[model samples]
Target chain A: MKEHATKAAAFIQDEARTNWHDESLWFVRSKRDKAAHGIPEWEQLRELASQIKDHTLSHLDEYLEAFEAKAKENGVTVHWAADAAEHNRIVHSILQEHNARRIVKSKSMLTEECGLNEYLEEQDMEVIDTDLGERIIQLKEEPPSHIVMPAIHLKKEEVGELFHQKLQTKKGATDPQYLTEAARQHLRQSFLQADAAITGVNFAIAETGGVVVCTNEGNADMGTHLAPLQIHCMGIEKILPKAEHLGVFTRLLARSATGQPSTIFTSHHHKAKEGGAMHIVIVDNGRTTQLGRPDFRNSLKCIRCGACMNTCPIYRRSGGHSYDSTVPGPIGSILTPGIDLKKYSGLPFASTLCGSCSDVCPVKIDIHEQLYKWRQIIAEEGHLPTAKKQSMVMAGKVLSRPGWYKMAGKSARWVTRWLPRPLIYNPLNTWGKARELPEAPKESFQEWYRKNRSAS
Target chain B: MSKAHILKAIQAAKPVPCPLPVVPVFEAETPPTREIFGSVAAQSGSRVVRAEDFVGLATAVRTIYPKDISIATPLRAIQSDIDLQQASPADLNGVDVAVIPAQLGVAENGAVWVTEADCVHRVLPFIAQHLVLVLPEDRIVRNMHEAYAQIKIDDTGFGVFIAGPSKTADIEQSLVIGAQGARSLTIILI
Candidate 1:
């Protein structure tokens, strides 16, 4: 795949759509701020959530064992997958045992990470994404652009056209209500006929051996309750030590996500419905690697609220599709590189180190700090592009010697002042491509400081 | 085997154990009130009705919904046109309105806690075109922390905190209520 910058450039070609995308995310961010301001204990909740996650990650092994034992007691099957391939295999085997060919799925980023829908399709099973945004993208044959708002990248007009072709809606209708009603009818049929339901776990409580799934539209409950067999796929990091901790997380989750006081439905599934089977797939998929990094272990504290994405300037302007990961935005920038450093090296550099993402993170993941750290690691591992590496090398040599630095600075100012516009604004000057060079000063700050202070 | 491998990896790579922080019950100057819950519920797209008794709740439900719609309920106080126990998941799909009892009500977000036992069919609360939750005024709590403290969440196979009617903003951030679940939610607090 191409780098994030290349993808971002392509995404920003349509200035009108890019500004709309940016404003839309900022609107959500403003709503989040309003919801957060309503609660006096918002910061306390973030701290408590962070600490609880820290404690849980520290004792993840015990929690997993406890969760597995209790789930077994509740008559639910617990499967562990060290990787995405194994996770998909386990899901397929279970489907084979039940002879289930038709499946309805709620939004699960873990399943997206595993490419479960594609894998199931390869096995000749009919898999449907029940979330309205997810269903739109599934029909459009693309991955979710944002974790929460899967179809945020697509305008209503585009969706209307896609539905016109796929769901046979009116040729040019652009009403979200009409489109949503059509999807509701279309997915309701899938839910009713589904042999199995698959959902993503928002929080898996070790004490209760249950998984909680939150949704604004109640698609997760619609699918899980109607289907005979239910499967909840969760990343290992989703575990919390106790059920009471849910109060802290849930209070923070929706408020941070869509700025709602709460999601429309927060369903807790402890056991299977009567005479039906329940299965929980705990997949690692490089979470342990993230957990091992002390600088990044706090990232596991994420509840996938998508708040960071809403608050991120780069994410808002560039669009989630620009990141080219299952999860896109600040959190994804830090997390994606750990999975494959060479391929995702550009992600950490996508940030401006503005720290807005960290400020807005519900669990207070130091997202920007981690992005900075990842850049260091990438450079140390020689993943930095040659042009950047050579320039940095030249910069370091000049900066280590004051005389050379002075000469270089003086020459740069002279060159900018005297050079022709085309020569200065050439293709090699990527920073100058979109920005005009600042006017050159006759005297440096050091020269001015010496002259001014000498009189004193 | 993967479980063992995963457990071992976690054991080896996990950070030093940290103490879990105490989650405090935030005390506002004034206790959470019914008015707060009602307004919040309205914001979330739910109609909140204050009733004096089950009779009043029944009247409110009847007043809000059309008389010809198919209503399902396990509450003896409210009349039902369909039997929940006999209704299969597919059969529940036809229910126009479902009135169910809530174990507890949360004042902070206008959410009502309903367990599987409250609705005989697990799908009743979601499958219905409109949802009616009868929450006793005395059972309402201040917040999620207080709500979790009072109830046994694991007592039933399934439970949910229903805040409002199902809604989504997936299409260009447009707020559209009644996505795939109930088109409307009416909470009758008695």
Candidate 2:
């Protein structure tokens, strides 16, 4: 896989698109700020949410067992998968048992990580993504650019064209309302004919043995209710100890995600529909490994609100696809490296270490701090690029020796004063490519300080 | 076996236990009222109608929706074109409007709590093109904390907090109401 820098460079080639993407995300960030400011006890809410998640992660095994036992009492089947391959196999077997061919699914990042769509399609089963953004990207044959707004990267004109070709919508109609209507009519048919429905769990309450799915478009509810068979896929960390925790999380989730007071539909499922089957699959793909890393375990507290992505300067400018992970943002940068350090080592370096992501995070995961920590680990593991390693080595040497540092500083000042622009600003100087160095000072700050102090 | 493996791994990797923080109710200086609920509902793109009784609610519903539209409901006062008791989930696809009773209303976010018992068919609220929720004005709560305290989530197989009409901004962040579910929501408070 291409590293983040190379992919980000290609993404930023279109200056207009880059600026538009950055501003669009900034708008969402601003909306989040407004909503958060309106709440009188926002900080207290964040603290409570963070503490709740920390407690749950520490006692995850007990909660999972309790959740399973309660779900069984509720007449819901529970399944567990140790890894991605096992998750895919377990879901397939469930489908096979029911002989379900046509499947409708709501947004589940876990399934994306497990490549469930490709796995089921290989078996000649028809799987349809029901979320509007997800369906758009599925038809366009691309991964989601944003988790909450999956098609945020694409323009309406592009979406209109895609729908025109696939759904037979009116040609050249770029109106979102018109295009959305066409998709609604098209997906309604899929929902009615679907033999089974799949949804992602937003929060699973062990107290009541229910799973909650929140959505603004109601796709999750539409699919799960219409189909005879229902399945919910969740990472084990999604478990909450009690149902009242929903009050804290539900208040924070939509406001943090899109600045809405609440999602249009926050549905809780305790049991299967009358005469229908309900199954919950608890999958631990790499979460246990992450839990082992004390530095990154807090990342599991993420509610998948995408607040970090919206507020991140690097994420806004570089775009989500540049990270090349199931989740692509500040949180993804910290979490993905744990999954495959060698392949995702460059992701941590994509950040500017701006604390906006951490501040915006409802659960208050120290996202930027975790990114910094991952960089240190990457360097120690020898996963850093040769150029970065060499530069850091040279910097370390020059800084440790005062004599060498002074000599280097003098020569650098001399060179900048005398050398031509072409010589100093060459292709080899990556930092100088987009910036111009300030004029060399008459003397170094140390020399100026020493002389002035002595004179005083 | 997979469950045991996952549990063992979690046991080994999980951190030291931390005490769960007690979630507290955030009380407003002045408690939210039905007026606040109506305003908040309007902000989220839902139409709010205040009615004195069931007869006024029926009149408001008739005035708002077209006469030829197919309506589905379990309400005794409101005449529904489609009988939810007899209609299957798929049979309710053509419903133009669905009027259902909400157990309670949240004043802070303009959300209404509805369970399967209220809709009869689980898909009625979403499958219909428009949704009309009949909430009693006296049943409004101040916030989510108060809302959860009042309702038993496990009382029914399925329940939802319907805040507004189903909407999406996926197409270039353009706000478009009515994406695969109801296009508009009208809250009739009786």
Candidate 3:
């Protein structure tokens, strides 16, 4: 896969679209601020939520066992998948047991991570994504750019064109309401016809053996309630110790995600419905390995709220597809390195280290700090790009020696000021590609400081 | 095999023990007043009506949908086209309107708690074209914290906190109501 910068360069080619994407995400960030400001205990909620997740993760094994036992007692068949392939296989086996051919799934990023749809397609079972945002990307054969707003990268005109081609809507129609209705009518039929439904878990309460799935469109409910067989996929890190923790998370989630006080529906399922079978697939898929890293373990605290993505300056500008991971943006940068360092080594550098993401995170995952930490680990593991490695090594050597550093600094300042633009900002200068080089002054800061303040 | 592998990994990776913290108690003001709840629910894309009695709720429902062909309700006093007891969940696919009773209401987000016992079919509240949730005036709570305290998860296999009609902003950040579920929500406060 191409590096994040390469994809981001291509994505930002259209200045108008880039600005629209940036502003669109900023609008959500401002809404989040407003929502957060509305609650008197918002900071308290963040702290408490962080604490709860921290405690649960410390005792993750106990909670997972408790959650599994309770869920089994509630008549749910709980399956644990150590990886994505096992998860896919477990879901397929369930469908095969039920003789279910048509599958309707709501927004489950875990399933997307597992490549469940592709796996099912290979197995000759028809799969339909029911979430409006998910359905748009599913039709386009693209991965979701934004977690909450999956189709945020596409313009209405593009969506209209895609719908016109796929659903045969009016060729020139760009109205969201009209296009949404077309999806509604089309997916409703699939919901009715689907023999099985699959959804993602938002919170799995270990104490009560229940899973909560929140959605604004109620697609998860519509699909699961209609289908006789239901499968819910959850990462192991999703477990919470108690149901009361939901009050804290539910309050913060939608507010952080899209500024809604709450999602339209927070459906709690403790057991399989009457005469129907339910399956819960607990997926590890690098979570346990992530948990072992003390510095990076906090990344598991993410509730997948996508607040970090919205608040990230780089993410808003570069777009989600730039990261080229199942989850993207700041959280993905810190996470993907743990999963596959070599393949995703460039992701850690795709940030400005603004710390906006950490400030906005509901669970208070120190996202920016983790991103910085990942960069160091990537370099140590010999996974960094050659240019970055060479530059860092050269800079390190120069900075460690005071005499050489001063000489190099003075020489660089002289070179920057006297050298021609072509000579100074050539192929080796990656920083000057999208930005102008700063004007160098005649005297260095150290020189001026000594002259002014050394005797004072 | 994956289950054992995962559990073993989790056990081995377990961190230093940290006891679960007690959830901080939030002592806010009382739940929203009838007027406040009405406005909040309205902002969430739902119509809220102060219905003094069952008859008043029926009147509001009729006013909301004057010419609808089919209406399903579990309420005994309210007359409707389909009785939830007799209708299959799949059969409620295109129901024009459904008047179901909500167990409780959360004022913070204008969400009403509805359990499976209240909804005859698990799909009744969602499959209906327009959903009318009849919430009693006394059942409203100040926030989700209080709402969670009062409800019992084990009492029902399925339950939901429905704040408004189904909605989405997926198509270029436009708020489009009724994406794949109820197009409108009417909370008739009794």
Candidate 4:
């Protein structure tokens, strides 16, 4: 019940548009469709990929062990963390060992989930976020709105203001190119001065003992090359069996997430630049419990592609802050429950059950299906209010018995017809401010169907 | 050091044996692509050509750089082909064109991936005033998934995916292409 997150949620709830957010996310999802549909073997490739991921998740312990062995041989030190606090401690210790005062980190949502930046900032270590969008939000000292485009909520003017305040650009100059150049120069100096670099693992190859970090702006390379030590933080689930699998994911990842053919994919191999050291920490905050559950295990196969987020109607409208987790959206709804159910009771109820997220998933993860399962889990745990359960039970009984259903349906139409649109909408829904609700007719569709059936 | 002594010293150096995965034979028969590749195109000012034969290849090469100008090739290529000679300091500074082979190509980013094999000292491309990449059209892939699908572990001794000739947005986000690499590229699709 952190008030900081609640304040963030309130801000997002005020700004999120059902239509625009859904459309924007769907637009990217469709770009993935176009890229994937053009390839006739796309379905087969997805099947192969799903199979590979499924196999890997089932044998994750074996592969992780194999990765640990191979990574050791490659001169990469391995660390394991059972929880976020342990993960943060291990990372901080590594930085301390390097005598690192200043550190540069790319967009690792895992670190964000762990609140590592806040933790380190508390310890008086300056952590600079290098990803352009991440940096924008970082400058503003706010949580990222979206995983891919962290600062998508902010416009260029807002970014200019943030940069002007943080980097101290000349007053009244807010050009994007100029701003980006300033950031590049400023970050370049930071990169050179940084003693260590931290990166999010895009893919961890067990066969090659390497980690792939896909970035569009080359920020990861800038920091990694300049720093003497490179530390990669990944969820235990990111492990892939071999280097060859990088293709299956790299092809589907960016197109699904951002409509790009691929993220400018960069893989770091061996140790950090000759004598430089590399450390990888594998973390399982709640993954073991997730792994034990067959129904929710497939959710772990996510490549961190934002496809589900983009396609989710509720997510687009309510915004990610409403989900109130390291990850958000339909995937987040199910994932949050696994990580912490009581705190995330409202998440499973957030979706419209549209199923577009599952349709657009490159790996064919049944996202909406998991949302449905999470609903059962939540209800079973008595997370739902007693009044809601009673009302739902009454409604279920009335619907199952066709006589009461017809009466209820007729009453619902009659009530909706009398209720003013404004009363039902802006004050309550609030979605109407940005998105329009469909106008319901005077008569119900079921009544029309009933009349037509009798006439035929 | 003489070649014999160097060979003896190389044998005397300790070999650090690490776990190497067995590379499975992958049959990569790339299909013809109509999508434009950026590295090859941007290198040659986004040049597109239709050449089905060797004569067409030569015509395309000569079209970019004249025949009187000697194109710089690698040390091994110079010894094998009499047409190319060992490039000197003058060639490094004055050579107008250099034709090099690429290790891979990614359609995902419109990148033609070349490596140190073509770079020699990472400067062979930079030092040359003008450049030409011998990108076989069939090497193009739609994304990195396909680009990485065909790789063997040993080939990364040194390699890079040259998306386009080195360009930088360092100076006020103005795209000044060919900052450190070749100022101009003429891609000969072989």
TM-scores (chain A) of the candidates: 0.99, 0.99, 0.98, 0.88
**RMSD in order of candidates:** 1.2, 1.1, 1.4, 10.1
Task: List model 3 lDDT by residue over A104-205, tens digit each.
Answer: 999999999999999999999999999999999999999999888899999999999999999999989999999999999999999999999999999999
Candidate 3 regions exceeding 4 Å error are A449-456, B53-55
Residue A10, model 1, lDDT:
89
lDDT of 4 at A427: 52
Q: Against the true two-chain complex, what DockQ does each candidate achieve?
A: 0.89, 0.91, 0.86, 0.08
Return whichever of 3 and 4 wins on TM-score: 3
- Cα lDDT computed for each candidate against the true fold: 0.92, 0.93, 0.91, 0.67
Q: Which candidate would rank higher by DockQ, 2 or 3?
A: 2
Error of 1 at B168 (Å): 0.6
lDDT of 1 at A95: 92
lDDT of 4: 0.67
Clashes (candidate 3): 0
What are the TM values for chain B, all candidates? 0.95, 0.96, 0.93, 0.63
Q: Give the Cα error of residue A448 in candidate 3, in Å.
A: 2.8
Clashes of each: 0, 0, 0, 5
Descending-DockQ candidate ranking: 2, 1, 3, 4
Ranking by TM-score: 2, 1, 3, 4
> lDDT tens string, model 4, A76-185?
89888877898899999999999997999988999998999999999989999987778888888888877876765555667777778889987666676677767766
Which regions in candidate 1 have their CA more than 4 angstroms from the true location? Answer: B53-55
Query: How do the residues B100-132 of candidate 4 rate in per-residue lDDT, one tens digit apiece?
Result: 776566654555566544544333454455666
